[model samples]
Target chain A: MVGTDTSELNAARAALVEALVRTGDEDRDAFRTVYRLTSAKLFGICLRICADRQGAEDVLHDVYLTIWNRAGAYQPGRASPISWLATIARNRAIDWRRRQARTRAVGVEDAEAVPDGAPAQDDALLAVEAHARLHHCLEGIESRQRAAIRSAFFGGLTYAELAVQAAVPLGTMKSWVRRGLLALRGCLDGDA
Target chain B: MATPDPDPDMTAAELALGVLDGDERAAALRRLVAEPGFAAEVEWWRDRLAALFADWPAVAAPAHLAARIEATLDRGAAGGAGGAANDNDHRWRTLAILASIAACVLLAVTTLLMLRPAPLPVRVPVTVTTPPPLIAAIAPTTKGAPIAAAYDRASGVVRIAGGVDVPAGRSAEVWAIRGTAAPRSLGLLPARGTARLAVPAALRGAMAAETVLAISIEPAGGSPTGLPTGPVVAAGKLSG
Candidate 1:
């Protein structure tokens, strides 16, 4: 919701949540509205993870269809509506990437990999309240955990993949993420 | 549901963070649905982790995607997606997909039927293979229907292509039979042409040069009993 003012953005956000709720009722019109408002953002996430436009398109299509079938399961509480939709897109993209990777001759994940700042490819500003909290807490944790968490979430990687890419043991990678998550929760909870 | 573990298994968190793979991923998925506390924890992890991606730079999707999805939705609403030929030729394109994915098994009659089933999400690839792939040409026994299946021992993927029309309110379950051994259910076949089935690891060994493959008509979800409870529509001996 690239609105000029906070009030307008809030209204657009509410509109999306309402539309998603209506989508549960099998309203095609409301589903279209949901698509119109969120497809671009979700498409971008899929594109980043899939690394292919056509594959991303196919993924985006599956994501929306999943939303259509699962809208009934969405809860207005617990999380932001946008966050909820974003989770579906991310999970779908990750699953798509994994399936393709497995089907096309499962290969070795390179040992000597690029550094952890690949997310720097996108310079978009964080636009939600949780964004600041997450970023702040992320900064508070150890750099290794922060980087591992970042790569795991954005890069759609598994502990095994992350371990191989970083030339570390799988247990080490898991420990980093597990400890980081506990620390992140404490930090965020302390703030809340 | 099992009481929320005392020390909180971080699987929910790992799942939310998208790092769990293979069995761990599958287990988390099962827990996600089976436990409310775990599910909420997952939602929590989802929200916090997803916040890291809130401002994914927006990119316009192709104009036709919405229409294509609408068509798929309509088809699903009419009847589920597979089994029927849709208006779009995408399925046909998928049917014609030829990527000589390597590995082999029982060979003779299954020679290149060009039995290409569309690539589907259901066919999970197991692992790399070195042995030759096996092809089973399942012909009708007592009844007349043509079905072809290719079994990759390495990957445990059984790609069944061709039509074996299922009677309404019933599903077609593929069975692997060897001699007097009881038929082992591979999985329910697609209502129409060309679909891949991942054979359970326990049943993968059942596929050999002379194993007999059969298809049976059962209740929608497959025979309630482990054994085929319906009539065998097609059966044949697989040859090398």
Candidate 2:
């Protein structure tokens, strides 16, 4: 079970909480520590969703700025600190991509470029380490809907974008994701 | 009732899912700020969907960005002329304490969960793949029965079957050769009956038309060295 295997993520989560707590207090050293530990994860999220490295880089800038500004708003027990940070990074990237949806589309050619060869290893912190129940629930859905939801979640693609990309009607894409989401919520809440 | 209008809860889910755009997203974000209940609902969705972020492969932000961010922050702090954070805020201290306590509790709870016995796997969707078009009828150079090999492209599984018998204590190892290059071991084939060998991801691309798939009988447990050591038994070229 993924639940049993979260020791490493939890340990990282624990350290992140300490760093973030100090960061909330405006401790520059702690903020630097937080960035050192997490920039790669946030950058990775931005790069995958945006696909354009430069756009992702721009979004990464906004992400850290928001993180530094909103570190005080994070509620520890309500969500893991890493999840909280990831949500911010992903949302920022999504917002950036959506704003660029019409005028500038992401280039698959840009995405194909070799990622920086530097040691970007997330130290085992970036994998889906927690949420065994959610993993189980996600597994129970149809592959197409599961795939749609996965794409929406990771790529932050809108229903229109998803439909256009998959060459399906907008309504079909919407139904696939919304129904998948509804089923997923039932599966999750049933466990809780 | 026929309309696709979603309720507030679903709207919150969509907002948290990051699937909304234009006016719909704007309204959701407005509601997120105006209504506490709506905000909580969005938070719930965000927390759950954040699980999918697990697959976000870590890419290091260019090193200079952090320094630049700090510089901009420092300038903003100095120029905004606003009071910086005051440590006297009771909420700040409380949050820091909660964070420290949560850290310890998280470690202990995770350890307890790990020690518990494994639960059964939940039912997941099975992706049934059709048999691949590329196949080879590997026949012996001399006189012997032929082994059929069908490569499934999507799954990288090569099904081998011919009902051929193997000599006692000998293994039929499969090798894939491209051009004049040396043979790469595609793992050992089953001694008898039908078996599926998962071609390694690196070798899956090698199973193209005109590529030769060969089998050899070696000491049990296949080749000790990387290259084939025993005599070749059968060989055939894969064709689309």
Model 1 per-residue lDDT at A13: 72
All candidates: TM-score: 0.56, 0.55
* lDDT (0 to 1) per candidate: 0.64, 0.64
Which interface RMSD does candidate 2 score? 19.0
**Clashing residue pairs in candidate 1 (N, C-alpha, C atoms within 3 angstroms):** B103-B133, B104-B132, B104-B133, B104-B134, B105-B132, B105-B133, B105-B134, B106-B134
Q: Which ten residues in a row have the lowest lDDT in candidate 2 chain A?
A: A111-120
Q: For candidate 1, what is the lDDT?
A: 0.64
Q: What is the Cα-based lDDT of residue A48 in candidate 1? A: 75
Q: How much is the lDDT of residue B15 in candidate 1?
A: 72
Query: Please, what are the lDDT tens digits per residue for candidate 2 over residues B1-240?
Result: 244565224787887776776556656644643354665566567667766656567787898989877876786565221111221133233333333323221122222333446779966557644544689999876798777888888777778886344567556678777644446667666545787766654455567888788776544444432335456668888998
The parts of candidate 2 lying over 4 Å away from their true place are A1-8, A72-78, A107-130, B1-9, B30-37, B80-240
- In terms of DockQ, the best-performing candidate is 1
lDDT (Cα, tens digit) per residue for candidate 2, span A75-141: 3443356666777677667755654544455542333333321222344453453345667888898
* Steric overlap count per candidate: 8, 0
Docking level of model 2: incorrect
Clashes of 2: 0
TM-score of 1: 0.56
